[model samples]
Structures are given as C-alpha cells and as structure tokens.
Target chain A: MIGIVGGLGPYGGLDITKKIIDETAARSDQEHLPLLLFSCPNLISDRTAYLLDKSNVNPGKAIAAILRQLEMAGATIAAIPSNTAHAEPIFSVVQDERARMGSTLKLLHIVYETVRFVDENYPDTTVGILSTAGEQICSLYREAFIRKGFVVVEPEGSQQEKVNNAIYDEDYGIKAQPVPIANKAREDLLLVMDDLKKKGAQVIILGCAELPLAIPERDYNGMIVIDPNRILARALVHSLAPDKLKPL
Target chain B: MIGIVGGLGPYGGLDITKKIIDETAARSDQEHLPLLLFSCPNLISDRTAYLLDKSNVNPGKAIAAILRQLEMAGATIAAIPSNTAHAEPIFSVVQDERARMGSTLKLLHIVYETVRFVDENYPDTTVGILSTAGEQICSLYREAFIRKGFVVVEPEGSQQEKVNNAIYDEDYGIKAQPVPIANKAREDLLLVMDDLKKKGAQVIILGCAELPLAIPERDYNGMIVIDPNRILARALVHSLAPDKLKPL
Candidate 1:
C-alpha cells in the first residue's frame, strides 16, 4: 500500500492522490493503486511559516507522526507531495525521526524524482519553477537541478512576490479559495508564468502542490507544464506497482 | 478527526472527501477539516457480488478491520461512503466489530441521516433512489424511508438494470472509468432520471456513491438531488466542530 502524507494543505495533498488515479491505467476500480491518505490539516502547521522562522514549530515531527500512522495502517512506500515540505530541515528531520523509529516505509523524494525525470526526458532544458517562497528560499529545486546539470529559473523581483501571494495571500490565494480557485490567484500565476516563459524557460515546473490546481492543463500555451505531483505519483507507481502505471 | 473508510471504489470514496472540502466554509487550508482516507481498493471484495451470493467472502470483515485502524489513527467520527456497504449485514458487522473491541469511533449512518434530512425539510416527499443491485435488493433506503413515513420510488425492471450498469458494468461503469466519468454512464443515468421523473419522483436520492459523481449538481433540472455523501459529510461536521459546517 502507498501512503500519502496529505494535508500539506488539504487539496494539495489530494492532488497527488488524484494524479495517482489518473496516471494509473486502471481498467476497473480494483485495478487502481491501493493507497492511504492521512490528511490531518490542523495537526501540521504551515511549512512556509516554519521554514521562514515565522513559526517555531517544526512540522516535520507532526508529518513524521502521520507517516508512522500510515505505516501502521500498512503503507509499504510513502510520498509527501509538498515541495516546500521537502526542505532540508523539515525533510531531513522527518527522515531522521523515521530512522530513529526504524520505519521501513521508503519515502520517495519528490525533488529527486522530478529532477531525474527531467534529466532523462528533457535534459539540458532551462527549467522554470513556480512555487511558494519556502521552496524558492530553501533552494530545494535549484540545488536539485544544479546537481542534475540543468539551468533553473524562477520568478524574479516583484514577480516572485506575486507568485507567493498567488499561493499565500489570505484573501485570494489558492489555499484560501475553494477548489475552482480564485481569479486573482490564477491571474497572478499566469503573469508570473509569462515572465518565466520570456526568461527562456523551455520547461515549466509547478513546484508547489496547489499551483497545479490553478494551472490544471499540462500544455499551458506550450510551456510543457511539469507537475511534480504527477512525477512523484509516477515514482510511486514505479517503486512497487509498476504494471498499474500507464506509459507517459 | 474524521476517518473515511474509503475504496468502496476509489473515486466514490474520494467524492465524499471532495464534498467535505466543498461543504466546509473555510477560508484557508488549515481551516478545512482534518480527515483520513484509507483507500485499499483491492483489499475488500465487491459488495454487490457478496450481497448476491456470487461470493462467500463478506466485505464487512475487511471494512470493520479498516475502521479499527481508523480509530487507532485518531478518528473520532467515521463514515463509509458507499450505499451498498450500508446494507444491514455489512453495516451491522462493522458496528458489532467496533462494539466488541470497545471502539469509540462514531460511525455515521449515511442512509438514516439522509432520510432524516429529507424528513425534516422535504416532508412527505416521494423519494427516488438510484443505487446498485445490492442496495435495491437489500431495500436499505426503502426501509429507512418507510420508517420515516416518506413515500419511496425506484426505477423498475429494465430501467433499474440500466442504473446498475451505470454503476457496475465493466465497460462504461462509473467504477471502471477514470474521473470525469464515461459519457455512456452519464447518458444512462440521465435517462434513468428522466424515467424516475415520469414515475413521480419529487426528490432524487443518489443512493450510491458513484451516482452523485455522475449527477453532481444538487438541482438536476429542478429535482432536488439529495447526495447522501454530502449529507454524511455534514453529519460528520455537525457531530464535532459544527462551526466549520456551512449551513445547508
């Protein structure tokens, strides 16, 4: 069984689960992958808040706690869909906590998987990342792309601030609005994506979980939208239930 | 925390989760309810097959087992979204198992709660139920409606078969297809609804989880489509954290 460490913002967590279902070439309900999603939204604090030192609570312990529950419920492999949550402090603490508990649940690294997927498929491409300030400030995707010998570009200056508000603004952010998403959030994201496209971005990555919901389509006016959620989902399918996975 | 006993069919399980998110009047991600969904699609056998004596294995045992795990995971209230799973044998088995183990997990009765909602609002209404062979054969909703002094109606003969196919047929069934559903399944369901409308169905009850997915809108060409999943979600919110629930 695959464990989804969800509620890294509720819909964002479910985005991975939805993609898993979509990516799997299931002929019947039974043909789909068996996964458990633990989405205790209130239990885990904001990843960005913790990363930015706006909050003292490390969400890693709470996330690791949920991972432990998933394992207890029979998850053999697990994945956390949030890019911001994959920062070194939060991600490493979760790993260390799990290791201390001797957890055998193999947690798939979302950044590593996305970088590897890009290396094999779209090698040497200038990758544009649109994510929360947490992932950008942590340099999570940048470090991974550098290791993979690929150029990385992100929203610059006030454009980056617009990207953050598209995710974090209390009034019109993706997380604040209902599932169809707010017009302001979508517009802000589109403007930033256009900026990235002009910055010589051949490939675009939705590094934040909530961004994919805003830009649901993969084509995105020919920028080759790469959702790390779907990439992580493919990684999960390949790890254990390879046959259920569809050809990309 | 709420536990969702999911994978009665993966998408059906997710429909309730989606509804919960929709029904909650939350401003941001943290404001959304904390819920866990365990969707082990292959673990439990088909509910209809077992109900029809085509299989000896009772999915009740497996469902009950999952409920126990949900309790351990810190779910105070729980719900199974499938209509057929609420048929006496399976529903009671889960309750009995929880009782035998001294479990405090509150399992919401989707059918009963739905009927009560109808009774309180749409009093003396003639309800039309669209469900699987298991629910129809078991008379689960029929019994519940009868107890509430409400008139009940269902698709008769060939139309009933079409409804079943919309839910269970291997080719174009809702369970067999991916999200967005099959055109055939949706067409079949809309035809059945037309038939039900002709039969004097004042209120339409989407008794099966998958039916709600097909006919998502509550106001289906004027008939009030009573989605039990949404009703169940509201019941969960009401039982605890009533503040989060949007007024129905």
Candidate 2:
C-alpha cells in the first residue's frame, strides 16, 4: 500500500493523492491503488518557518513519526509531498530519524525525482523555479538543477520578495488560505513567470506543492509548469507496479 | 483529529473528505479540519457479497479493527461513511467488537443522521432512496424512515436490479470504476429516479455515497436530492465545533 505524509500544510497531500488518482490507468476501483492518508496537521510544524529560523522547531521529527504510523498501518512505500520539507535542516533530521527506526518503507525523494524528470525530458533547457523563501534562499532546488548541467533561473531582486510575500502573506498567502487560493497569488505567479520568460527560461518548475494549485499543469500562459506533485505521483506508481502506470 | 473509516470502496473516503473541505468555513489552511483517512480496502471483504450471504466473511470485524486503529492514532471522533456498513448484520458485529475493546471512538451512524435531516426538513413527504442492494433489501434504512412517519420509496422490480448492477457490475460498477465513474451508473440512476418522481416521492436520498457522486446535489430533474455525504460533513464539524460549520 502507498502512504502519503500529508498535512505539510494539508493540501499537498490531497494534491498528490489526486494526481496519483489521475496517474493510475485503472478500469475499476479494485484496480486503483490502496493507500492511507495520515494527515495529522497539528502534529507537524510549519516547514517554511523551521527553515527560515523563525521557529527553532524542526518539522522533520514529527514527519518521521508520521511515517512510522504509516509504516505500522501497512504502507510499504511513502512520500512527503511538500518541497520545503526536503531542505537540509528538515530532511537531514528525517533521514536520521528513519535510520534510527530501520524502516523498510521507501521514502521517495520528491525533488530528486523531479530534477531527474527535467534532466531526461527538458535537457539543456533553462529551468526556472518558484518556491518558498526558505527553499530558494537555501539553494536546495537550484543546486539540484545546476548539478544536472541546467542553467537555473530565479526571480531577480524584489521580484523574489514579491513571490515570497504572495506565498507567505498572512491574510492571503497560500499557507494562510490554501483553498480558494487568493486571486493575488495567481496574478503574482503569472507576473513572475513573465520575468522568467524574459530571462529566456524554457521551463518553469512549480517547486512548491502549494504553488501548483494556483498554477496549471504542463502549460500555464504558454510557459511549461513542471509540477513535482505529478512527478511524485508517477514515481509512486512506478515504485509498485510500473506496467499499471499510464504513459507520460 | 477526525478519523475517517475509509476504504469501504475507497472513493467514498475521497468523496467525504472533499465534502468536508467544501463544508468547512475556512479562509485558511489552519482553519481546515485535521483528518486521517485509513483506507485499507484489501483488508475488508465485500459488504454486498456478505449481505447477500454469498460470502461468509462479515465486514464489521475488519471495520471495528480499523476504528480501533483510528482511535489509537489520536482521533477523538470517527465515522464510517458507508450506508450498507450500518446494516444490522454488519453494524451489530461492529458494536460488539467496539464494546469488547472498550473503544471510546464515536462512529457516526450515516443513515441515522440522514433520517434526522429528512425528518426536520422534508417532513410528511414520501422519501425515495438509491443504494446498494445490501442497504435497500435489508430494510436497514426503510425501517428508520418508517419510524420517522415518512413513506419510503424504492425502485420497482428490474429497476432495482439495474441500480444494483450499475453500482456492482464488476466490469462497469462504481466499486470497479469509481474515478471517471461509468456513464451507465448515472444513466441507470436517472432512469430509476424518473420512476421515483412518478411515484409521488418528494425527496430522493442518494443513500449510497457512490450514488451522490453520479447524481447532482439539491436538484436532479427538479427533484430534491438529499446528499448524506454533505450532511455527514456538517455533522463532523458540528461534533468538533458547530460554529465552524458553514451554514447548511
């Protein structure tokens, strides 16, 4: 059974689950994958806050505990859908915790799989990204794409801050209001995409799971929106039953 | 945390979760309810087959075990979102299992809450239902509405068989093809509904959660369609915090 480490702000889990639903080529419900969604949002700390040092509490420990629950509940393979949660400060501790447990559950690397997708399909293309301030400033995703021999583009100057505010704004931020996402969030993302386009970016990856909800899959405003959620979903299908996975 | 006893057929869990998302009066992610969906479909047997006595395995024992897992996972209140799951043959065993374990988890009776809603809003009106043969033929729901002083209507003869096949045809049934639900399921339900309208039925309860996905909410061909999943979502919010519930 597949396990989802959800509640990393809640909606990412739902997003990836829906993507998995679409990814599976099934003629019946029994053919659809059996999975468990352990969305204990209260147990998990905010990933962006921990990475930003706004909070000393690292979310990885709680995330590790959730995975243990999923493992105990019969999930052989699991994935955490949040991009920010993949940072050094958080993911390092998650690795430490899992090592201590000797877990048999295979935790898929959301960013690693995504970078591989780009390397294979959009090779030699200029890649751009939109993510939380923590991920961009930490260079977690940028370095991944750079190592793949791809020139990574980022929002320059105050445009970076604008994108961050659009994601973190207390009242209208995606974190503050995930569903019925603020109109400004979409408008701000589109505005940033225009900047990336001007920079000669061939593909813009929605590095954050939350960003994809406001942005479309594949093409948005003629710019390629590479949703890691969709990649992670396909990776999940590939993990257990490769033949059951639909063609890309 | 609210625990959902999902995996009765898998899609029902997704259905109820989405409804809860819609029923929530949240402008932000934190305001949304924290939920755990434990969907182990392979662990449980077919409810319809058990009800028909074609299978000796009772689903309640597995259902009761799932609730225990939910309770241990820190769920204060839990619910099983299947109508047929509440039948005497299954629900009685569920209660026995719970009593034996001394579980504190609250399993919301889907049919009971639904009957209460019908009694309060559409009083004195004939009620029509579309559900799995297990729920209908067993008189599990019929007796409840009868006790509430309402005449219950069901599909006649072959129409009832058609409704059952649409939900469990193995090839085109809802249990088999929940996503991109088979068109025959919707067509079969509409045809049966037309007959109910001719029978002086005032409110048509989408008694089965699967049926609600194929049928429109509130109105279907000008007939009042009562969605139990919507009502159950409201009930969940009311159990936790009534003020948080979006008005009806």
Candidate number of the best TM-score: 1
- Candidate 1 per-residue lDDT, tens place, A160-241, comes to 8998898778899876774669999998888888898888888898887778878877777568898898999999988877
Best by lDDT: 1
List the global CA lDDT of all models.
0.84, 0.82
DockQ top scorer: 1
User: For every model in order, what is the number of clashing pairs?
Assistant: 0, 2
Cα lDDT tens digits for candidate 2, B1-248: 78888877676777787777678786545577888888776678888778888999999999999899889878888888888788888889999999999998887888888888888877999988887746453386788999989998889789989888888798888767867889988788889999999997888988776677677658777678898878887788789877888975
Question: A74-123 in candidate 2: lDDT tens per residue?
Answer: 88999998887888778999999999999889999888999998898889
Reference-based lDDT, residue B185, model 2: 82
Error of 2 at A201 (Å): 3.5
DockQ of each: 0.68, 0.40
> How high is each candidate's TM-score?
0.91, 0.83
User: How many backbone collisions does model 2 have?
Assistant: 2
